[model samples]
Target: MPQPPIPVAVLTGFLGAGKTTLLNFLLKDPFLADAAVIINEFGDVGIDHLLVERSDENVVEMASGCLCCTIRGDLIDTMHDLLARRGRGEIKAFNRIIIETTGLADPAPVLHAVMSDPGLLATCRLEGVITVVDAFNGMATLDAHAEAVKQVAVADRIVLTKVDLLEGREGEDMLFAIIARLRKLNPAARLLTTHRNEATAERLFTMGLFDPTKKTPDVQNWLAAEAYATGEKRGRRHAHHGHHHHDHHHDVSRHDEHIRSFSFTEANAISPQGLELFLELLRSYHGANMLRMKGIVKLADDPSSPVVLHGVQHVFHPPVRLAAWPDADHRTRLVFIVKDIEKPMIEGLFKAFTDQISGGADAFTDTTLSLNR
Candidate 1:
C-alpha cells in the first residue's frame, strides 16, 4: 500500500507575536516527538533556526526526535530537498511537518505554494494554519498591518500569547477588547491562550478533515460553517442599521473592517457544470481579494457523495469527493474569507450560474459580473 501523505501545518504571526516561543514550547512536548520543523527566514543569515535550541548543520536532530532545518532557497525547492534527503536516509523519519513562516510574511503565498505544488501534494497534505497573536500588542498589530488581519482570518487555530502581561483594569479591558475583535475577524477559528497552557500540540495539530483521536471525519469542526453563518447574519444586521461606533477601539480596528467572513448555503443540489463556472468566474474576477474559500458541495448528479473544495486565492486543491455525507445535513455550504468583496456579489454570481444550469440557459455567454458595483 502507498504511504499516506504527511500532514503539514503552517505557523504564522506578526513580529513579536511569540511564534518562536510557542514553537519552542510545543517542540518540548512529547506529543510532537515525530514532528519535523522547517524554519523560513528572509535574509541570508537566518536567526530563527539557530534560536530553535538545536544547531549543527542545515538539518539538526533534536533530542525530542524532531528534525529542524532552514529554508535554503525558495520554499518549493526546500521542501523537495527535504523529501529527497529523507528518502535517502539522511534525516530522521517524521510524520508531521511544521513550517514556521517569517514574521512579516503574508502566509497566502506559503499556502498557495503548498496547495498548488503537485509533488508536495502526493507526499504531504496541508493540515492547518496556526496563527499566534500577541495579546499585549495584537490590537496595534492588527490595526497597522493588513497581513496580521489576514493571518488571523485564515487560521484554523488562533493562539493568544503573553496574556500574563495583561495586568490591572486597563490591561484587562484591552484583553477583552482584543478577544472580541479577534472573534469578529474570524469566528470559526478556535481561540486559545498560551498563558493558561491551552495551546498544546494535541490542540494545534490534527486540525484537518480527519480527527486522529476520534478516528472519524470531523466535518463540523473542520468547516465551522455555523459560526460563519452566525457572523454573516450579524454582519448583515450591522450593515442594515448603518450604525457606526466612533471610538478609539473602532478606529484601531480599521483593517478588520475590510475583511468579510461569511457563509453561503444552498438547500438544494447544484449542477457540476454550474459549480465549475461559478468557481472559474470567482477566481478570474476577485481572486486576489479572496483570502480563503472552503465548502462542501451537494452535486445534483451525486447528491449522496459530496465534493469538498478548498482554495487560497486563485489556487485551489483538487476537489475530493467523499463516499458519504459526514452528517445528516446534505445542503451545500461554502464559507469565504475575503477582502473588500461583498457577500451579495458572490451569492448573486453563484445563483446566476446555478439557475442557468438548472434552467438550461447559456450561463457562460449571457451572464455579466462587475466588481465595481
Candidate 2:
C-alpha cells in the first residue's frame, strides 16, 4: 500500500523577523497541536529551539548552524526518525510538519530536499513555503542582506509580521512599500498579514506541492527563476570545482580565504563511516571558513537511495536517505559556499579520506574527523 504523504512546511524570514514568534503562535494553535516542529538556526550556539515553547518530544532541533548549511544532513535524519516513530505508533499522528529556518538560510536547498528526496516525496509533500518579513525593518533587511532577498523571492506565501509594531502613519507607509517589494520578488505567492490574529498559519499552509486530488502543486509559480537569476549573478558555481570564472583570466581568492562556492564529487559511492569522517575533518580544519555545504551523495551500500548531506561551518547534521533519485544525473552533487577557505583544501581533505577508506582503515584510524571530539 502507498504510504500517506508527509506535508512539510518551511518557515523563513530575515533576522528578528518574528519567525520564532510566529512558530510559537502555531505551536499553541489548537488546529495544529499535533504538527511536528523542526527548528534550524544559524550561529555556533543555537537558542531558537529554546525560544520555541512546545513539549520536548514533538519539537526536534537541528543545531548545525543553518538549515541550508552544515546541519542539512541532520534535518533529513530527524525527519526519517520522526516518520519511523510515527509509523510505529510511538507518537501522535501528525497531519503536518513545520520547519523554522535560520535568518541566513537559503530556502532553495531545503525545498530541493523536500522535492527531490524520493523517500520524502513518496510519503511526504511540500505543503508550502512561508516567508515572514518584519514590517518595521523589512526595507533595510532586503537592502542589506542577500539571504533576505533569497528568502522572500522563493516564498510560496509571504507573511507581513509585526504589523502592530508598525501601526502609526509611518508604519502604514512602510507596510505598503514592503508589500510592493514582496509582490515584485514573488508575484505568485499569496500575501497575508499577521499579528495576534494567528491567521497567517491557516493561509500559508493551505497549499501543497502534490495534492492527492489535484495531482499537482496548487502553488505553481516557479520560484526557481529568481534562484537562477541569483545563480547567474553568482556565475556558474560548480560544486566540486569551487570558484566560478567570469570570462578569461581570473585571480580569485581560495575557498577558505573569502566568500566562495566549491563543488566536488566522489567517483565511487561513499561509505557511511567515510561520511562521518569527512564531517569531522570539516569541523577540525575548515569549520570557521564554511558558510554552507549541501549535497546529494551516493552511498556505497545504499547507492540506489542517495544520502543527502548539509552542513554549516563546523556542525554536521546526520545524513538523510532518499528513497530514489530525483533525476538522471546520479553523481554526488556537493556545493560548498564558504568564506575564508580554499576549495583545494576542502577537496584535498575529502580525497585523503577516500584514500584511507580504500586502504582498509577504520574510524579509529581516521585522524581528521577528530575535531569535535
Question: Model 2, stretches more than 4 Å misplaced?
Answer: 41-73, 196-198, 211-373
- Candidate 2, 1-373: lDDT as tens digits: 7755667888899888888777666655565655666666444343345333332434442332111112445678777767777788755567777777878887766766665566675678676678889988887787767678767754667888878888777777777767755654554466777865645555667665344444433221322223323442343343334434222221232111134444666666677887787787677677665655556777778888887665656654456577776556676666665655656667655665556445545433543344333
Top TM-score prediction, candidate number:
1
Best by lDDT: 1
What lDDT does model 2 reach?
A: 0.61
lDDT of 1 at 176: 85
Backbone clash tally (model 2):
26
lDDT on C-alpha atoms for all candidate structures: 0.83, 0.61
TM-score of each model, paired residue for residue: 0.90, 0.52
- Mind giving the per-residue lDDT tens digits that candidate 1 earns over 1-373? 8777788899999988988888878988898998888997423443344344443567777767788788887988888888888888777788888999988999999999889999998888788899999999999889888899999999999999989999999899889878878988998999999888999899999688733345456777789999998887776675666356424445554688889899878877778887887888788888999999988888988899999888999989878788898888888888899999888788766766556335535443344525433
